[model samples]
Target: MTQTHTHTHTHESHPAIIKRLRRAGGHLNSTIDMVVQGRNCLDIAQQLQAVEKAIQQAKKALIQEHLDHCLEDLVGPLGAGQRKAMDEFREITRYL
Candidate 1:
């Protein structure tokens, strides 16, 4: 994708992204409270893990959405070689 890809305006911003992040923040706060309240170590670990997973989900959704919208728009008409590269690139992004 071109450098201008970041500037492309989609129909809506990352609403799901925001929601996941907010939920993660709430979990983090709860985790902190749990720590202060002498909760069981295993329970605290589980709460922290929940926070980590929520943040990770938000990150993955953001990357996939960017690829789906911005990259697809910028690479409007790909040639044979470019098409192969694009497809391979998409495959690699699955790691995100």
Candidate 2:
């Protein structure tokens, strides 16, 4: 007897996303440096907040791009399947 399996995957990758993530990484490294240098708590908190927001924005952009490029393309016209997939995506977004 023989068995076969298949897997399909698409990566959500964009240059802008990469740039934003790199910026966030740099900000995080700076935040660590600030901690080492004993910066003010408020200053550290503000930098951390900025880093968090940058990461959040990057995530938002990546998801939106996936929806636009992959999901929207896959679902195409306004049909039952399309509507169901869109609804499922909307429900999933509640976590964000």
Candidate 3:
């Protein structure tokens, strides 16, 4: 049997996601500091939740960009390998 493959690449480096993740990390540190200072539980929880949401937003943006640019290219003018890659990407994203 002949095997065929399709490859897709992105020109956009997506630095914004990295910056957002860094900001989220800073928020997490602040939340930890609040906890260490004996702040109220509700306040700490709110800050932690904000960090989580920021991280989630960054993840969503990265995923959306990948789907829009990489996956779209793979699905067109390609073969079975590209479809397999898309399936793998979906599986990996299940954890996120």
Candidate 4:
């Protein structure tokens, strides 16, 4: 069975993050095309690596932004009981 967990941060992704993701998406598409065309293995690997790095960077930026803005605002005045849960969440995000 698959369980879904929900996050409370509903804010839109930062523009830079969006751009980064979109670029990564485009690169991913190009990588697919390259594979289909039987491009050199080394060239395909390089493109795939670029796509992977781009996506990783976008994810990192989004997570950082969430911690910077959403969590900062929410946690600032959280009650002691509430903060414990948020602190747990904060710790979890670090692994992402």
Badly placed stretches (over 4 Å) of model 1 are: 1-13
RMSD of candidate 4 to the true fold?
A: 4.9
Tens-digit lDDT track of model 4 for 14-84: 77887999999999999999999999999999999999989998888788677757767864777788778
Q: Candidates' lDDT values, in order?
A: 0.84, 0.83, 0.81, 0.82
Error of 3 at 5 (Å): 16
Estimated TM-score per prediction?
Answer: 0.74, 0.67, 0.65, 0.67
The count of backbone overlaps in candidate 1 is 0
What are the RMSD figures for all models against the true structure? 4.1, 6.3, 8.1, 4.9
Q: Name the candidate that leads on TM-score.
A: 1
> Whole-model lDDT for model 4 versus the true structure?
0.82
Q: Cα lDDT for residue 81, model 1?
A: 94
lDDT of 2: 0.83
**In model 2, what are the clashing residue pairs, if there are any?**
none
Candidate 1 lDDT, 1-96, residue by residue in tens: 655434545435488789999999999999999999999999999999999999998887877777767777776977899878877887787686
lDDT of 3 by residue, 1-96 (tens): 998658544446477888889999999999989999999999999999999988997887788777757667655664588768876876677577
The lDDT, on a scale of 0 to 1, for candidate 3 is 0.81
In the range 39-81, model 2's lDDT, one tens digit per residue, is 9999999999989988997898778777767776675666897
Question: Which has the higher lDDT value, candidate number 3 or candidate number 4?
Answer: 4
Q: Find the candidate with the highest lDDT and give its number.
A: 1
Against the hidden true structure, what lDDT does model 1 obtain? 0.84
